[model samples]
Target: MDRIEQFAPPAGTAGTTTDVGGVIERMRGFRSHWPPGDGVAVFNEVYLTVTETLGRHLSDGAFRDREAVSTLDVRFAERYLAAVDTAVSGGLPPECWRPLFQYRLHPGVRPLQFALAGINAHIGHDLALAVVDTCRTLGCAPVDLEEEFERVGDLLVMLEEQIREDLMPGPDLLQVADPLTHLAGAWSLERARDASWSAARMLWRLRGAPPLAEEFRSRMDAGAGLVGRFLLTPCR
Candidate 1:
């Protein structure tokens, strides 16, 4: 099968599940489906590692509010899974997700580019919205979830550093003059996490104003997609 076919959801796993374990299961399914070098697989592998880490923390009672954190984690994962389903079903994913899906199989894009582009889309767009979704589901406010958000963000940050270390081209090949170096330098996960928190707060405030919330979401999606496009610039 082609890469896209490999990404297709197995017979009964297309719908989003309500638990972190379920989300991790779906991601693992994707990992097994795609080739090691497949762009989506690259991102899936990174995400899977972070999610597994979060799950361990949850089991170990690491969070102050386990239920809230669990809800947020599951909800957060659902957004990305939904995007994958959209692409698999031949529908348009959110603008922020478009670039990675569109360029998934590009020969010119490195695995690092694919991984970062997917991270950009997920954090830049999905994260803020996930916060809103989690709040709505739990009948809580954004402020209430601040600690949980930070904990999750910290896990992601740790995994991101590992991803860079593992995927980056060696010093002999990745020079200051390389476009990959420039692209990698241009985006910061820490910055993205801060922006996502701000956006989540803004979105929460706009919730009562549906039209405004949608407009803000649309703009954020578009802006993120633009960045993803830039990150995926064929560096080969």
Candidate 2:
């Protein structure tokens, strides 16, 4: 099955529109349904903040290509939101998302891991595909959106630092030698962002050949899933 078909969102879950405001509303809706510490909610809250900021940036003309940036941001958020919908409805989420949902409430899985696993799936897999989606929507090539991609990526990198600080448990809850710190430090958003850029370029190149593109996308999904599973490995 195709990526979207593999884990279809329930009827009526399709995004109302791709505007920045719409994206934030959809994320907020998910946040309303899931608890503050739920794996999906953890990521959604972080992403919601990012999207709201991007919306503000759009109003102020912070981007040289506002339309391109908005479209890319909206499309990227949709993929993550769809996975949230599927998980909420008891459907099997994509493998890349399975670990986050499965280990969401495990006592041994730190909040940092929950946040990073979501980042892994979204950036390592969804991002590359999102770039392709944006290219299709804009009738342009990946090269055309490279600047916007970097701008979006920079936002993510900045968010990564804040998420760690915000989600970290109190000093009383963690020891000086906590294993969770080691586990969390193992993953890097910068490395993932660089790899995603390469993956996006490759997918765009293979766009003319459906079979090759599908194969590449499948491998990328599986590879990212493995990383997510590793990131979520219990570390008390």
Instruction: Report the C-alpha displacement of residue 116, candidate 2, in angstroms.
Output: 0.7
lDDT of each: 0.91, 0.83
Model 1 spans > 4 angstroms off: 1-6
lDDT leader: 1
Pairs in clash, predicted candidate 2: none
Task: Residues 32-128, candidate 2: write the lDDT tens digits.
Answer: 6566766667777788888898899899998999999999988888888778777766687777888887777777777778888989999999999
Cα lDDT tens digits for candidate 1, 40-148: 8899999999899999999999998999998988888898999999998778999999999888889999999999999999999999999999999999999999988
Cα RMSD for candidates in order: 1.3, 4.3
**What is the alpha-carbon lDDT of model 2 when measured against the actual structure?**
0.83
Error of 1 at 192 (Å): 0.5
lDDT of 2 at 148: 88
